[model samples]
Target: MGFLIGQTYRKMVGILAARFKEYDITTEQFSVLCRLAEQDGISQKEIAARTVKDQPTTARILDCLIRKGLVHKEMSAADRRSFLVYLTPLGRERLDVLLPLEKATLAEIFAGLDAEELARFRETHLQLHRQLDALHQQQEA
Candidate 1:
């Protein structure tokens, strides 16, 4: 099951990456952008947490987004040492364009699954995530 899950994840990333090629964005970058779109002006640490990405990885992804003019980092007034990330106009426009494509891609991939099956799949995945989160917390403790 782990192997299957890994393969599915790889395939999903590959498909999304290919689709995003024209936009010059990676799957990881798109994820950060989506998180920012959901809530702009968030600290890098918060973005990392929301995206489930490590600090270094999130910083690198943010660097790329900044270079692409999709995002910009500003010093947090509340925390001088930290930076808040916000999506630029270009980033918002790109996300607007990609949102439909993302939905269409999911629809295509899950086309064979009926609504009930899709719900069940989603529920199972949510349960798995919760279990993993608990295990991670236990390890941390």
Candidate 2:
């Protein structure tokens, strides 16, 4: 089951990465952009948590985006220690172009699946993650 899940993930990411090449972004970077598009002006720590990545990894990604002029960070007014991340106008424009491509690429990945099956799949995955999280907490305790 783990192998199947991992393989499916690899396949999906591979497809998305190929589709995103022209936009000069990886699937991981694109995912970060998507998260920010949903809600911007978040701290690096928040982005790391939301993206399920380590702080260093998230910082690296954000740094690359900043170099590309896609995203920028400012000292948070509420928190003097951390910076809030935001999408630049270029980032929004890039998203406008890539969003449709992302949708189309994902549609290809789920080609034959109906809405009901997709919903069930989503729920099952969520349940699995919850169970795993509980197990991890138990081990830590």
lDDT of 1 by residue, 88-113 (tens): 99999999988888888889889999
TM-score of 2: 0.94
Best candidate, TM-score-wise?
1
User: How high is the lDDT of residue 107 in model 1?
Assistant: 92
lDDT of each: 0.93, 0.92
> How many collisions between residues are there in candidate 1?
0
Residue-level lDDT tens digits of model 2 in 1-141: 999999999998888888899889988888789889999999989899889899999989999999999999999998899899999999999999999998998888887899999999889999999999999899999
lDDT of 2 at 108: 85
Clashing pairs in 1: none
Pairs that collide in candidate 2 are: none
- Which segments of model 1 are wrong by more than 4 Å? none
- What is residue 70's positional error in candidate 1, in angstroms? 0.3
Candidate 2 residue runs with Cα over 4 Å from true position:
none
Error of 1 at 69 (Å): 0.4
